[model samples]
Target: MSGARQFTDRADAGDRLGETLRDRGVDADIVLAIPRGGLPLGRAVADALEAPLDVVVAKKIGAPGNPEYAVGAVASDGSVWRNERAIGGTRTDEGYFEERRKIEAENARRKAERYRGGRPAPDLAGKTVVVVDDGVATGSTLRACLSKLERSDADRIVLAVPVGPPGTIADLEAQVDEVVCLETPAGFRGVGQFYANFTQVSDEEAMAYLER
Candidate 1:
């Protein structure tokens, strides 16, 4: 077979992703990594591409009764991507939706500010933007992030990740110019399955990645 074909960790996954992007002649003006888990991979990708590293934050709007189950997501600038299927199926009430939207939007804004650390947000206009995330599961948050980038007028948006299911990747392809994913295997589990050292990244640890 062709080796293990799985990542040792987020950093290893990012190294492979960076190599893939480079081999494909992908060029980017900036690399925007989704905060928390994506920061490590984002740092590696930015270093590989010789581009500035930045963050794009989005908060999941969880179902009222099920806080972990996302009904939608809102980006830092209040741009939103609703999981209409889930919302209709769950029949989420207007009061819950509005309340969660406001709260999550504010949370996203604060996270964006923290990641930027006084640096003026980069202008995405007329620029090829590379968006990095460790891996996607439900894809709600990533969709919201892409929607925010869409509103910001990024010239071209490329979504890069180490592993995601084929169907998820296909759906994302409609939202971005290119989707660079390393493995799309069958019998998909959580993203953590593809990594060996899938440690929980602390807030301080994540912020440190942005600094470097």
Candidate 2:
């Protein structure tokens, strides 16, 4: 994929991604998207693959004083993925990290519960689980979601996305059984850069995708 190329929206990207997966003969028992941006794409992928859609939630652990910058991320199940370089660069101590981790983990748990609404988590045992996302920049939260999946009984784990930076996508590839990224663009600044309509997805809209 060209670094200069852009997607029309999440739906267009999802359609293309689903076609790519089919072309590669990839099969999925379930599609787990990282919400809330991921849900839109996951819906298309789920329809294309004729699989069920669900969410995997995670919360970013921001750097000290810079809440927008992620030092790490924690999944709903307490699985964590830390950016050691970010932590060291920010001079964040263990105490701060632990405190933030606990807080953010609980946040993630609540969000997941809210999204699922009273439904139980899907069983992944002996199943092919394809994890979807809109796009990845630093991939802190996505990594945390992958960490949680790694601890599951899934027979296979695949990461799918519309776009990502080369380095970040490459790093994520090592963590999954297979990766189906449509674009690994050069000079990547952020995930929204590759999309024409990158509006923020509300919790209500995100949850509706699962209901479909």
Best by lDDT: 2
Tens digit of lDDT per residue, candidate 1, span 136-168? 888999999999999888899999999888899
- Candidate whose TM-score is highest: 2
Name model 2 segments beyond 4 Å from true.
1-5
TM-scores of the candidates in the order shown: 0.96, 0.97
Q: Clash pairs of candidate 1?
A: none
The residue-by-residue lDDT of candidate 2 on 1-212, one tens digit each, is 55543898998999998999888888999999999999999999999999999889899999999998999999999999999999999999999999999999999999988999999989898999999999998899999999999999899999999889899889998999999998887888888878888999998999999999
For candidate 2, give the lDDT of residue 45. Answer: 93
Model 1 scores worst on lDDT over the 10 consecutive residues at 1-10
The total of clashing pairs for model 2 equals 0
Per-residue error for 77 in candidate 2, Å, reads 0.7
Off by over 4 Å in 1: 1-5
